[model samples]
Target: MMYDQLKVLEKTIIDIKKKYQLVNDELNSLKQKPNTDPKELAALKTQLSNYRNEHDSAKKQLGDLDKRYQNLAEAHHMIGEEQDKLHKQLADLQRKNSELQQHNDQLKQQNHDIKQQNHDLQEKNQLAAERTQVVLKRLTRIDQMEG
Candidate 1:
């Protein structure tokens, strides 16, 4: 976009320069014309004045355009800075999300280990209870036999 605007400004400047050059050539040609009538000279002077006015106007317009281009350049720079900041923010967010994912995986592994330990403890408790029950039955049979 900036390039496009610059091109337009360059073209405008070129056109103005061409117009000024043409006016200058015309004025030079009028000066060279020998023994020119007073009325003709006066007319030429009027034409010269008109050309000067046009040149001045073009110069003023060019100045205005230059100011506008400067403003646009500043705006473009600011937008570029904002884009860089946003890109950095996105990168930081991605890094943070990756860290969180790694933490989640670690927590999942710990949960799995705890569940296995709980299962092993439950099996051990069940085996101990079965052994105690079998011993109590044998003692009760022996006591009945003695009685």
Candidate 2:
């Protein structure tokens, strides 16, 4: 699960970098293009300004995603430690000469809850990835048309 999140985060970072570069290159090309139509030039400039804003937004999101990646890594490490502790506790409980049904059930429930949370996180991450891909595709289409 953490690995999937890492992949998604890395992909997002790459996409944002690509977008930034594409926008910068387009702006440079606009600068080099011969001045023939003032109206068209103004429109292109407006479009470039919007892309610049979007590029800045993507850059900010990339930074935020990096922080989230770090947070997820830390959470995974903590979850591992917690699982280890729970396993040890379960072992000790099993060694006791008493009914262990209730304790075992509680542990099982905790495990189930953790699994559910991880599943939900994975789904959300996947949805976010889908949305990012759609946006990237749209941007590529626009770039192609403009070029």
Query: Which 10-residue window of candidate 1 scores lowest in summed lDDT?
Result: 27-36
Tens-digit lDDT track of model 1 for 12-130 = 88898899899989888877888458898788889889998998999999899989889888998999999999999999999999999999999999999999999999999999999
Q: lDDT of candidate 2?
A: 0.90
Q: Write the per-residue lDDT of candidate 2 for residues 6-48, one digit (tens) a residue.
A: 9998988888888888889988998898988989988998998
Model 2, residue 24: C-alpha shift (Å): 1.4
Q: What is the TM-score of each candidate against the true structure?
A: 0.82, 0.54
- RMSD values for the candidates in order, in angstroms, are 2.3, 42.4
Residue pairs in candidate 2 whose N, alpha carbon or C atoms collide under 3 angstroms: none
State each model's CA lDDT, in order. Answer: 0.91, 0.90
**Span of ten consecutive residues with least summed lDDT in model 2:** 94-103
> How big is the RMSD of model 1?
2.3
* Clashes by residue pair, model 1: none
Query: Candidate 1, residue 145: CA error in Å?
Result: 5.0
